[model samples]
Target: MAVLGCYINMVHPVQAERRKALDRFKEQIRYARDFGCGIIGTETGNVHAEIIYTEENFKEQPYLDVVESVRELVTEAEKFGVIVGIEGGVNHPIHSPIVMKRLLDCVDSNNLQVIFDPVNYLTPENYMNQDVIIKQAFELFGDRIVILHAKDFVIENNEKKEVPVGKGLLNYNAVLPFIKTNKPYINILLEETKEPDIIDSIAFLKRIYYQTV
Candidate 1:
């Protein structure tokens, strides 16, 4: 099981709180091997004290803050041979494929990698272009991605509202084919999907995965 150190806000606007979060994340990195997991996953978070959506997170300093925090985590992870798998979202600093690519370039460490969740990257404004976005992510950092989060979403009131996998707008065809070609056997974690739905989601993914050839 991978360590889900996903709550720490890597770009907290407060310096002290940010440091504390980093320390806790480092602690997780140090002990991940004991848990038989090599990778610890997290999101490049928002700038505000509260983890809410804000346009300010799309600015330069929050992105820089994430870079700094990730670099530190990567350094600590390298010593323990743990990988830091960072996920991006529309609401956070590393908000898209391009920004995620920039952070990867800036960190420049093999210990630093991606936990790609296509639904997390989707916004109402961009969900319609998901095929393009998914293609961009694979083209940019498919090799860097160590985990995939499987979920789906529906558009409601012009917002992207998440639902169980295989019950919404995500195109597994766009995702699983790439996984089959370039990332076979990679771990796919189900996000916010439960019981009976989980079984169906698995069946849905397997059907496409086997047909991708």
Candidate 2:
């Protein structure tokens, strides 16, 4: 079995408590290296608020905090020769392709990378134009994407809900080709799947994979 990466959970926002989180992240990096995996993944912890990213909450302070924290984590990850993959989303501090690019530029480490999940970056305003968002993600960070997550989302009752792959509105038709042409060997992980649903999700992704080729 291929273990592309291991995830590190978010830590508490308190400044004093960040040490423990960094220790755990370092441990995960070590574990990934020992297991022969090249990547370790995580979301930026909710440092400023529970739901970290919002129009009002999106500011320079929080972004700098995340960038500083990741800079330290990348230092540790470099020791293990493991890439640190930050998962971006609308809820996290690194919310968009522009922000992600900024973080990468700030960190300026090859060991730092991205775990691309297109659905996680969507909002109500941009969900309908997801093809453009997906394209932008690949265009901006394609070289840094270590893994791609396969999932779907829908706007139900004016709330966006994640569903099984191919069940929701994600356009695998666009996503698949981008991955095939740019990062053919990147791992595609199926998220939100149960034991019974795994088979169908795998089948759906495989069909898309072949069709994209």
Candidate 3:
């Protein structure tokens, strides 16, 4: 089944009145489960919790709440028989994949897993051990990976911008061989394929994926 993710803002800093937003996120996942998808993925909190090892905005509440949010969703997702994957992405507050592993350990839900896209963490400002970073992520998350995001990055305006997958430096076509070798049945979710070309990209990915199998 194709995995679809939604950032329902399960945990956002909306004072206290908007508390219902978290439940709404859970409902969205329940609906996704009804549609026959085995997994529903989510991005971490909008504020990069201190997990990235940056001293900026390193507070205890956001750190504790992000885990609580994942736990709540995963608990409900288990009732629906759907797995939940928390994505590690670009510009995310919890940018380090290793910190993500630690958070996963704290939640430790049966329905919880990882959805990864390594290039999302890539930034031109700091090369910061890219290969070792990826290898370590796989070492920690290989077993829990339930979905992959197919996004590529390019340096633009001094920051990474999303570009079409095959056109960018990140290697989706090459990554395929590795993913299938490790986790043969995991779903690959494509993002940021311009509206005009989404159909083509999905079709192209299917062709390449099947050819390898």
Best by lDDT: 1
Cα-based lDDT for every prediction: 0.90, 0.80, 0.70
Q: TM-score for model 1?
A: 0.97
Ranking by lDDT: 1, 2, 3
List, residue by residue over 66-158, the lDDT tens digit for candidate 2. 887798889988888888889888876677888898999999999999889999888877898898888888888889998898988889888
lDDT of 3 by residue, 1-213 (tens): 577657655445564522575677678777885687887777765543223434332355555667787888888888888888788654454567777788789988868888888886677764345666677778887778887888666777786777776666664555565687898877777778787777777776677677785
Lowest summed-lDDT stretch of 10 residues in model 2?
1-10
- True lDDT of residue 165, candidate 3: 62
The stretch of ten residues in a row with the least summed lDDT in candidate 1 is 2-11
- For all predicted structures, in order, the TM-scores are 0.97, 0.91, 0.80
**Better candidate by lDDT, 2 or 3:** 2
The C-alpha local distance difference test score for the whole of candidate 3 amounts to 0.70
lDDT (Cα, 0-100) at 147 in candidate 1? 90
lDDT of 3 at 56: 38
Off by over 4 Å in 3: 48-60, 172-174, 195-213
